[model samples]
Target: MLQLIIRRLLQAIPVLFLIATATFFLIHLAPGGPFHQERPLSPQVLEALNAHYGLNDPWIVQYGRYLNHLLHGELGPSYGHPGHTVNELIAQSLPVSIELGLWAWVFSLIVGIPLGVWAAEKQHRWFDRVCSTVSTLGLCLPTFVLGPLLMLGLAVGLGIGNVCGWGSWEDRLLPVLTLGLVHAAYVLRLTRGGMLEVLNQDFIRTARAKGLSGWTVLFKHALRGGLLSVVAFAGPQLSALVTGSFVVETIFHIPGLGRHFVQAAFNRDYTLILGTTLLYGALIIVMNLMADLMQAWLNPRLRVSML
Candidate 1:
């Protein structure tokens, strides 16, 4: 297992570099540069600015220099926001994004797993039907649509929290709920389906034959095994929610890496955009690796194969 983990980590190096290179070139390929604006700048000042940032160099040379700096942990300066490095901006904004992501994942698990279990337990009953209906609706709604609707329902219509602001935790209520609710629905469906399948498996039947009480059979034998699938699914889903929260954050006006990423993209801040992308890619890759490890831990057969 340790060797497998080390191998995965070693492989991630090139993936990160590839992501960085792709981000660097894609940003440059856009019609104008970070310096380009609707209002023109003086040619002399532009030339000086270009020279200062090493934009005067050929594209390949500039990219090579950028990669070299990256190797040294210098992610470059903020293009539009002077007096700030890309790392500094990420440090400032990442907390909010991380907080949102944490809450979203928790909310997803709390709501989805239980609801799925309950639905599965009560299959063909009203509770199961209701959960199915709710999950369907959540799956259907886009976060952009859901965010405003939630704001309207909770903030405007119900007047529970502020509609827009980053002043307090209350401001996060609707956004977090909005971002998490849909993911919860997905998790619920997956957990219920997985649990139900486990319940019907041969081992579950054997446990029943051994006269184990229903609860013990369900919890000790079924739930743990069933949870393996859910845990694996949750990792990727959480990563998606974390990265995709940019839209939800923008709609809700939350101060997070997501919002900052969008802002950097709009401003053509190459370093900021590439740095953020690299960070996101690294995070997702790490989470996925962790999930794989967890799966092996849960199912010893996988662990044995790895060994």
Candidate 2:
């Protein structure tokens, strides 16, 4: 396991470098400078700003400087917002995103897994059909649409939670539900399919013939194998959770890193954009590694294959 983890980590290095390199060049190619505006600044003023921030340097030189700063764990200043560094902004905002993501993760698993199992157990019945329909609806609704509808139904009409903003527990309710439920639909579908496949196997019939309790047969014999699909899906799902939901965060006015990342892109805050992109890329790699490890532990055959 340790060797497998080390190997994965080693492989992630080049991927991170490529992400950083591509983001650096592409962001620079976009029209408009970080300091550019409808009203032009005096050339002297612009030159001074460029020189002070090293933006006047050649692209290769700038890339070199970026790498130097990045190596020291320094994400440089935010161009759109004067006097704030990328590091400071992320430190302030990332916690809210993580908090939101964690609750959503828990909510997804709790709601999706059991809902899926229930649907599969009652396959071909009304309950199964209803679950299938609901899952389809959930999958079809994008966060942008679902977010507003949730804001309207629960926040505006019922006044159950805050309409927008993030601080207390109440403010978190709508955002978590909106993001969690949508992702849960995917999990529900995967879990249902996996459980259904497992349940149809010959061993399931043998377990029944052995007169094992229905609950034991389902939970003990079937559930572990049934979760393979969910385990596989977890890597990307977890990365999305930890990174925060951009649409949900925006709709709710949550001050998460996701909102900042979007703002950086539009505002052309070069350092901020690159910082967030690289951070997300790294998170994705780490999450995938963790998922692979977990899957290997669950299935010994996977461990052998890794070896």
Clashing pairs in 2: none
Kindly list the per-residue Cα lDDT of model 1 for residues 1-307, writing each as its tens digit: 6788899989999999999988989998987777888898889988988898988899999999999989999889989787899989888878777788888889999999988987888888999999999999999999989988988888999888776766688887888898899889989999888889988899998999999998888888888777888888888777666664778888877777887677789888899999889988888888898888888878878887866
Tens digit of per-residue lDDT, candidate 2, span 1-307: 7888888899998998899899999999999888887899999998899899989889999999898898899988989879999999889888999899989988998999999998999999999999999999999999899888988999889989986888788899999999999989999999999999999999999999999998999998888888988988977788788777778888899989898788888888999999889889988899888888888877778988888
> Alpha-carbon error at 76 in model 1, in Å?
0.5
- What C-alpha RMSD separates each model from the true structure? 1.7, 1.4
lDDT of 2 at 215: 92
Give the TM-score (vs. native) of candidate 2: 0.96
TM-score of each: 0.94, 0.96
